[model samples]
Target: MSDVGALGDPALEDALTGLARRRTVLVASDLDGALAEFTRDPADTVPAPGAMLALRGLARLPGTSVAVVSGRDAATLAELTGVRPGDPVALVGSHGAESSVAGVTAQRLDDGQRALLDELTTTVAELIERHRGARLERKRAAVAVHTRGLSDDAEQAALEEAVGLGEGRDDVRVLRGKSVVELSVSHADKGSALLALARVVGAESVFYSGDDVTDEDAFRVLPAADGHVTVKVGDGGTAAEHRVPSVGALVVVVRRLLALRSDLAPGAR
Candidate 1:
């Protein structure tokens, strides 16, 4: 990889330039902590000031596509991102269990999966009741136990108990994230969802950015090639090729990409 960092990486610009020339390109990102700062209450999160605008602008460009892949369910992801029906940007939620993009559908639960989800919900709800500040978030295909507002000891206790719910269960997929643990009934993940999206859109290149451990699934699947720009926002080890310190820094990088692509479009001399 290039020695340049994410904020002002000339190599990143080079990658963007190549993508602009490609027949199709996909610009996608995770919602929480990547586009928006993490809020104690997930419902209150919103994208950085011009994050959505830049994404929307990129989507409108010729041969370009943009999508948001989030852990939130499709409807809630749209609501939090200010994405309305008919919006150009596509959406994938529930860590790829749900989708609003063309040619991609949400995960369908069978009777067994539904029953498993219900059990997970009940267990997580009980954990929340005992954890005081912890909360349980119900999703379309998964149930998450969030410890964002809990004290240090309480958060640890809640996470430990929540994780135990998935132990010895071959059917359950347990995903641990920052201050949260999710137990999913479906086997879907961001990597598979992202690849499916790329195929449907016929994208020759893809740029994806994310901030959480769950996002590692997407990063690991994206080849470390020139046009496949993978970025990690915030800290911790990542499979992403580049790293940005904050959501604001990531926004700047995206806007830079938008400007570069715009310059290449057919127009005045």
Candidate 2:
């Protein structure tokens, strides 16, 4: 939770540089608001200029792996990022409930889980109808109520109502984010996904960046060590040890890491 201000902090820079030289490292990040700007319509979000290229550069480095961990479904995440089968970057979607590395795949919901999701989706849709500016996002294993464009009071009411809908449902898990409340049938979380990805790649260290409450799960799972760097891309309380002002600033950080890794690559002059 130490707030190392901006990427220019000498200590942070040194840590990132050192991490780049590690024998095995994993770079994972949240897609929206970390690698790409958040759009009112999630479908419209796109990566910041050169962001994907920077990630690809890191993936190319020796003993390095990269992943985009997002709330979007696996296919949608892969489509949005333009990452196809056989790409080096892995995709973890639905807050880690679903994953795609060589190809897209999703968690299979059982009959009970499907029933719960149906009920939750119906409830959220009803709530959206009652409140203007409220939107419902249906995912593979979850349904989200987004209140971004609503008035503060209206948003609070909508969120509370959504929470109430899930109060007695043991079959579902409730999660609150920046301006959205999600009811998920699957218990998967960013912490589990990050750890699993690290294990798969045999990464000795992990550098992760994210900008939402969901991102906190990933932040908490990273070991407290010089090789591990966790960064919060925007304002608000976070478990990450460093902070950058915005997604644009995060792109700069990625590019810098790519350059550092390039400089340290074997046989570099």
Candidate 3:
């Protein structure tokens, strides 16, 4: 795993500098492990000091856009991040199944999809009941089984059981992330959401970051040759071209980019 020193690498700084100079650019990141450190209780998670402030500042720059694209539901993401309605920093949640971006419509479940989600919710609740420390998080088009506090054995058991819930079901999409398994009736992913957001904002390049396996979808879709910057927050094999050791390191990167971009135009800072 790369250490925090990775932030000082000239290549990364050059990439960020180039990205800042784009005619239009999108700065997007995942909330949980990218902007915020993981908390014992998910509800307790908040952005690292000055992280959101930097993102909001970047959003105010000419031809620049900022977004928090996460697996969280839209309303909870908004409430937790303190981003109000019509805020410049866009929020895409439910792994792209939900959104607070102006031109992107919210997701609605059809009768069949709703029925499948309801059934999955009941089954997951029963499974969680059997596993002492497991928790269930319900979303607009999905349910997540959290095993954060479980023992190694218990966590494995709970995750296996959760994965089993989608077996033999083509209609279900199962995503396994750090001590959590999510089942969604919708197929939307971070890659699609990022692409759509870029199109809507007319972004010529993007800077995206995340620390989960699901974030790989977004990473794979970003082309490094296009001056797009993709960062992985922690230790793991990733499709992202650059790596920052922790949320704090990521905050440094954002602040640096904000400063560089601000320097591009007078009185913008």
Candidate 4:
């Protein structure tokens, strides 16, 4: 980790350079707050500054692969990221219930779990509807209670309600992100996603980038290989091997990876 500071570090390049050797490299990144920002402006949606270009450049690299692992569902991810379905890039959406890559399976909810999901979604939907600012993001397999621009009390109420909704389900897990309460059927963690994706690319080296609480699941599970570089954006206690201050920093690291990609066929990155 040389001279890269809080935004990124030298260790990332070391890991990326090694990844250039693989027959294929898999790079997984969280979409919102990582690849793009949440906003009303269509053009401003991608991560600030040159982030989009940086990621696009990385994807252009030969023998390197890209995956957008996001909480948002696959359809939404494709619409936002402009990755058409069946595109080379893999997508892990709805926690892990859906992966765009072939041969990958996600945890499926049983009938009992489905009933509980219906209950929770209905409960939160009704409760949040009373508030002017709250929004109910129904992900089916997972439910999110969002307090987007709501008052402090509303946020707290949502959290409390989510905790109540998650009652008595040892199989289900509730994770709190920067501004939302996420309840997903405990099929897979981000770490499991990373490990599984690594095999798909047969990556000898790994680089993981994300922001928020769920990302710790991936950071903590990085293989013990020296070439693995785990990057965490913003402030948090993460198991990542390195830290970058924000998504903008992640763009720089992607640029470095673009440079590191070895000679291979076009359209293979």
> Each candidate: what lDDT?
0.86, 0.85, 0.89, 0.69
Report the candidate with higher TM-score, 3 versus 4.
3
Sorted by TM-score, highest first, which candidate order results?
3, 1, 2, 4
Tens digits of per-residue lDDT for model 2, 173-263: 8888878899999988898888887887888889899999899998888855746889898889988878888898888888888888778
Stretches off by above 4 angstroms in model 4 are 1-8, 21-23, 40-53, 223-226, 262-269
- Candidate RMSDs in order: 1.9, 2.1, 1.7, 3.5
User: Which digits, one per residue and each the tens of the lDDT, describe model 3 over residues 1-269?
Assistant: 22345377777888888987777889999999889988867888888899989999999998898999999989999988999987889999998888777777667889999999999999999998999989999988899999897899999999999999996789999998999999999989999899988998899999999999999999999979767899999888998988988899999999999988887733454
Question: What 10-residue stretch in candidate 4 is worst by lDDT?
Answer: 1-10
Candidate 2 vs candidate 3, lDDT winner: 3
Count residue pairs with overlapping backbones in model 3.
Answer: 0
Off by over 4 Å in 1: 1-6, 265-269
Query: In candidate 1, what are the lDDT values of residues 28-118, reduced to their tens digit?
Result: 9998999999999887898999999999999998888899998888999999998998999999999888888868877899999999899
Candidate that beats the other on lDDT, 1 or 3, i.e. the better one: 3
* Cα misplacement distance, residue 255 of candidate 2 (Å): 0.9
